[model samples]
Target: MVIGPRQDRRPTMNDVAARAQVGLRTVSRYVNGMTNINPEMAERIRSAIEELGYRRNLAAASIRPGQTSGVIGLVIGDLANPYWAALARSVESVAAETGLLLTIASSEEDGARHDWVVERLLQQQVDMIIDVAPRTVGRSWSHWSPPLPPVVFVDRPGDLAGADTVLADNRGGTRDAVAALLAGGARRIAFVGDDRALHTMDERYEGYLLAHAQHGVVVDPTLVFETSHSSGQAVDLVARLLREGRADALFAANNRAAVGALLAFRTVGTRLPIIGFDDFEAAPLFDPPLSVVAQDVEAMGRAAVRAGLDRLQGDDGPARVQVLPTTLQLRGSERP
Candidate 1:
């Protein structure tokens, strides 16, 4: 029997196609994760594939004509967070223009998870990397570089040591928001944000301090709240502040923390003026509409992808820290 490896060559797509009585194109599409496979035929093809021990040579398939130029790997802190999700969508859209597939992985704000995700993407030979909200990798990223792909930081700014970055105008926008609040008669404003170790968080905090100094408003260190970037912790801290009567206005540093503080305020039935860093859904629908420093999240994503593609095309463009502008929108929450 021609059963040993020496006698029987490994099963290929052709063998599976022959066994399933399906066209080569049908089997090809199934293996490539493409759609349009009927349920019954898909089941039959899968069974035949298993029976024949057929495995796709992904490396070979990746370089086929009209096939993917490998994947554009995106690593973000959290997919549930709207900023990262919007960024991922934008990256996918831009990558589509270059005929590259997008593979997104969420680190959930953990440094180890971020490292693992990037390593896995590297193993798969992604064409490029985009990291949004990376924690500890910023300083040492240059030391651990990928062989073929270049890494780009998105949303959260970092000194990636030669890596490109796309970030929102965090400091200027926060200062503007604080100025608006001061003008609205909000004297007792409290700052709530993530750990100061984060680059964007630190920048936003600096803006807040700068605004306070400019307006001759004293920074009451007692009113500043810092959490470990936890949604529940943000909610708890905001709720505690409301109970203690420390703040008449709140400035949320990031979107998730902002949403959590909003939820806490709603639960407490407080209508204190609130301005969030990132605009979110249903902000206008709340009893008191929310004021926010809104970044062009989609644009940031597209810019990151564009930068990566440009580098991939052998462009000797200067490595830039592209900071998109942020807008402060007036809402009922900031009106009074």
Candidate 2:
């Protein structure tokens, strides 16, 4: 039998102590932020820690009584989306204010992945969790029993009971977009969106119908398309609709679908009226600037963090939902 060094092992505190020529207690004190050590000794320990690349185990430290992990876990759907990215930035800003570390995970709207990420966050003993629930996973929190840490839902609310939720006004935003198109003299407006199973998509679709009804304009079922939230799929769907000349204007329910529709129109050298939900980068730079229904993403993020903090502070009140408003930003794209 041959014996070799353990290549997988991380450098331990004992290694740091030996390198610093200090007692183990001195190393422990330095790692724990104790101020009783001499300056010279502290310098030696710091140098040793740097040289050995020592990292304190936050999970182990949090296990001690009265010690908190000071970490918040955030789970979002599709970090690639600009809306989700902005929301994350807001959450990070608030977490910084509280001096808590934030760990972010992308579930990609997959139920299994969302569950797995939540379990991992719990294992790390995070102070709380902020999540944008997966489209298919309703009531995900029911799987876990009592003593669960505080959780706040953002963007989309799942069936998690007694948890606070923060969401944009999806239905009203879409309705406003449709109404604007109508006022601009668009008689045949097309609606493109993600799967209807998602709460956001369903709400937006409802708003589309309501806007048409209010204006005494009947919607054409053929002009409305629902796909798997893919930009390429959206491009293909919108291209078919354009080829058929079915719509005088378009309402894209989300950012990705909007980009797809834009590409489809650009491909055919046609500039039909368009309005989209969720503003993204360079939206104003198009040939005709894209109009959008803009949500206060940063405010939503801040509100989520505040709600989580409140729960941590022993506010056992009934669950609350915060529905923030959206605004229409017109830059000539809504005009026919």
Candidate 3:
């Protein structure tokens, strides 16, 4: 009878040891890259490993002291969003430089899905996690407890006390955008933004208020609208505001909302001064190129990766909230 190892079974170190006619410890040392093996024995083990298609199990190897699976995980609100996509690419680039693999998942802005995706990443034994947390629905970070790897938050802060965070100066950016519109003689400025529950949006809204306060302009509450993270909804809301001549200028607090506002303005043929936060792919190609408060997404991504790596390296320092500056891009749309 010519029986052999199961075809479906992956070859293991034991199989390599048997095929090499060596002790299991010898095979272990060879696989783990330890030195001091006989040249002939090393040759036999190498040949056996190649012949059997044997691969080191990284998950198992990570259990040892000073070892890692060499994988990092990123959780973001939506990968389809250009801002998040850019951030992911930046993180991927940095990770590639260090020979670390990155695994990314989108939460779709659902709090439950966010928790589920995080749990799955944890199961994969990632060395660390970088997250751009989703807006929760009636839930706070204080309520949930899941064993987590070293985590660095990007774009938004999480409820975990002392968790490292990298973010843009949301308030300063929006304040500057509003100030620009006011400088261009825009009164009755309208503010459109994502969910009020989101910290990022809230900060932008605060900036809108602060700018008006500083400039001695009273903000009309009727001109501000907070909607779901939907461009279509933003279009509808903005279209109504424009048609009714309720707002002479608009400040869209996100890329998606800005797109919606653009479409609405085009349909109504209203060339109202507009400033958007988070520049998008087509922002510069509009009839009058869109002006924006551009966040340093690449820097945010790089900083998040560095923070996670620092935590992994046992920095154990005080948690940091690094806020990168945002720049106002005056691309003609802000001119009144």
Candidate 4:
């Protein structure tokens, strides 16, 4: 038989994972000094290591040490946005309760910047991290693994194994809201929001599609627009949709989208029933009182902090994902 790549090359963690018949994460955990693994699984990993002559860097820094820096790093998207600012405020409150300081960084929705901020936080030796979201949760943080500190993801679910995540019931809330709006009488509701690359937007978009599926109504694909994450982008897209006269109602994915929709409608001197996700400070003051699917920003912050604390306090359990509920606050919009 021809020589296999494994036979000619230095064994790696990937090789160990295959030989041990376990996930790469399990192999990683055993090699990276996390001792909470099952004993049988541990033996398999150990056996693989010995057979492969794989050398573990005895001096490699563990993901986290027994000591803490009394600081919790917070990485969010666009701190200037009211929703994000509110989340940061709530996180600070929980951090203060535990005699910890918060180190905040705005990713500006940039993947490179998000990675840079994470590296800088590691250099500063923050106790742990709580990130709102980065580019794409499933693959964004794949670069940092073994030595990365514990992270609790908020606003979206992260793909990291054993990491805690706190999020709103995005799909469920949107489904309920859209279903209710449909039950009322509005058809041809347009979905306007951020790009689908974002996990939150993807979930909400799914909710939008599911609602249509439930109603047995075919969605006009043209009515769905995934614009850039900006007020200007939303305004332009919504204005174009308005000119087309293709929508009877609007479903805004987030607060900024909602604001843009309102502004666009005002400019045209026309109105449609609008239901948006995320509540802003001025929603109550709107002429017709904006309706929304409101997520508990404070609760999300608290849950993320709690999970981070648990990880620091020797809780080696599996990752805890908390999905808080959302309420449909109907004022005068989204009603037939």
**For every candidate structure, what is the RMSD over all alpha carbons to the true structure, in angstroms?**
7.3, 4.7, 2.3, 15.0
Global fold similarity of model 1 (TM-score): 0.79
Clashing pairs in 4: none
Question: Per-residue lDDT for 223-276 in model 3, tens only?
Answer: 888883788998899889888988899999999889999899888888688999
Q: Give per-model TM-scores.
A: 0.79, 0.84, 0.93, 0.78
**Could you tell which candidate, 2 or 4, scores higher by lDDT?**
2
1-336 per-residue lDDT for model 1 (tens digits): 322122368788877777887889899889888778988878878988887778788677754544444689999887788777777888898888877899999987777777788778867777888987566553345546545476788877655666799989999999999888888888888888988878888889999999899999998998787773776888888988888887888888887777788789878877577888888777777767888999998899888988887887777667788999999987867754
Give the TM-score comparing model 4 with the true structure, all chains together: 0.78
lDDT of 1 at 106: 92
lDDT of 3 at 103: 95
Error of 3 at 290 (Å): 0.8
45-152: candidate 2 lDDT, tens digit per residue: 998888777888878887675567899899999778888899888899999999998999998888899899998898888888999889767345888776667899
Quote model 2's TM-score.
Answer: 0.84
* Full-model lDDT for every candidate: 0.80, 0.88, 0.87, 0.84
lDDT: the better of candidates 1 and 4: 4
Q: How many clashing pairs per prediction, in order? A: 0, 1, 0, 0
Q: Candidate 4 deviates by what RMSD?
A: 15.0
Q: Which stretches of candidate 3 lie over 4 Å from their true place?
A: 1-5, 60-66, 137-147
Q: What's the CA error at residue 284 for candidate 2, in Å?
A: 0.9
